[model samples]
Target: MASGNVSSVTEFILLGLTEQPELQLPLFFIFLGVYVITMLGNLGLLILIGLNPHLHTPMYFFLFNLSFVDLCYSSAITPRMLISFVKENVISYGECMTQLYFFCFFVIDECYLLTAMAIDRYVAICKPLLYRVTMSNQMCFMLIMGTYMMGSSGAIAHTVCMLRLTFCDGNIIDHFMCDGPPLFQLSCTSTNVNKVVVFTIVGINVLVSSVTIFISYTSIISTILQISSTKGRSKAFSTCSFHIIAVSLFFGSAAFMYLKPSSTGSVNQDKVSTVFYTIMGPMMNPFIYSLRNKDVHVALHKALKKRMFF
Candidate 1:
């Protein structure tokens, strides 16, 4: 029906999570609360890390960046996603592209950062005597730089590939965001290259990161078992468990979202996975780490005491 393609397209309409009127309001409030907590939790961790001298180790350094990434990751998508809940989610081409770029950026960034943290944990657990040397200031800086670089490259790749597509059909994105699958579905042009690039890049990332995590955790478990005392082994397991949970949640949802068969009757399932990684993942990270970490608890109490005294 429409002859003009993405070139002539000025805007796109985002069909929110569902069309049901009854579900819309409830979903809005739920995600609103989630976003609020995401902000507070992540921002609080960032500030706490900055203030607490005790948390200035390689472990906390990774966490500081993790918090920062989660904050940005949540911010990049949540605000725009929230708009879909209340009103017409009409996003300009530029805005949509921008959102897509940053969304890809943050997600990819989190992937590598989590891998880096796993390595950090590996060094801490498996090679504690050399932890300082292995995860030095310079090394941490480099790892972080590489993490962001990958994010930038992945985002650029996806966005550039997407830009090449010609959208002549209804410019309506079925999901809340400008995700790859829905956008590819709307293209009048062939998306073979896009598919190859998508799977190649995402698969490489997931494979490498997940393999690294698996190896690190396996070694960590072995090392913990070698501990002589029950308390020592228990403590080691306790410390690593939080990171394991975060990794499983993030990577599991991400795999479900990206690696699934792109067939009919699967849009809702994809959206659910997307929402889990994009919405719930970031929100859960800060809580997962802080709630279990004694250092964060001590730091919070000390900060509160200082505030009370002042």
Candidate 2:
């Protein structure tokens, strides 16, 4: 439909993680282990939260959503990556678009969701008396729904814009998956709309979410400082530390990757940055949340004890 000098690029060959034959087996097992851990940790968290009554709260509810996101996020890239390590890492145009769509959707959802979680924490810590009134079930549900809508909308915008471009040039996506930038690179057309959409979406999502986090943490820090007791401050800081770490890892990597000038950063550099959010962030999420959050630790302990006794 779209007019371009280049007409068709049916399938693409993915340049996987490595081409060094000697490193294949070791890398395969390492990723296999990472995937297994990601599945078990996230799945276990979800199940523990679902079964345990004590863990039924706004915090855990959002956490449950986060676990689900991490699970889907990892599945979107990791399984294919695993397979690629073993065999040919080739994907069709249709399949590549589908992967890009879902991957974009979940990744964007996480940005919004994490911002919402920060707001929730801000309410709980800074405005404890109004926590219930502020982060009510209805409100949480609405926030989650809004996040999903934003994610879907962004994904659709990117995917639709991508579809309009004629990929008549080259189809060699020089990375593990059909990432947004690499996909854009393969287009035979000018890709003006694609560039605009990418810039607008990335700018809006990152700017909005980052601003929300900054505001939330500002209030939170003020509240923490007002507490004269060192122990109290430490306790509050500890609770929020995990979230801050997660946010830093997720948003920092995203900002670095998406906010950079494409003309300045090479495609390979972009791909490397993408690996932080796509692979590293997901891998680190459960470890960060479970190990750092006291509530999750208690829930895990209680669940294990109950299972052993019963």
Best prediction by TM-score? 1
Each prediction's TM-score versus the true structure: 0.97, 0.95
What is the C-alpha lDDT profile of model 2 across 1-310, one tens digit per residue?
2445646877888877776788777878998898888888889889988988988889889889999998999899988777767888888889989999999999999999899889989998999999989889999999999999999999999898888887766767777888777778778788877888888998999999999999999999999999999999998998789999999989988988877887787766776678788877877887887786777788888878988999
Q: Candidate 1: misplaced stretches above 4 Å?
A: 1-7
Whole-model alpha-carbon lDDT for candidate 2: 0.86
The lDDT per prediction is 0.90, 0.86
Weakest lDDT window of 10 consecutive positions for candidate 2: 1-10
Total backbone clashes of candidate 2, pairs 3 or more residues apart or in separate chains: 2
Best by lDDT: 1
Whole-model lDDT, model 1: 0.90
Q: Report lDDT (Cα) of residue 265, candidate 2.
A: 75
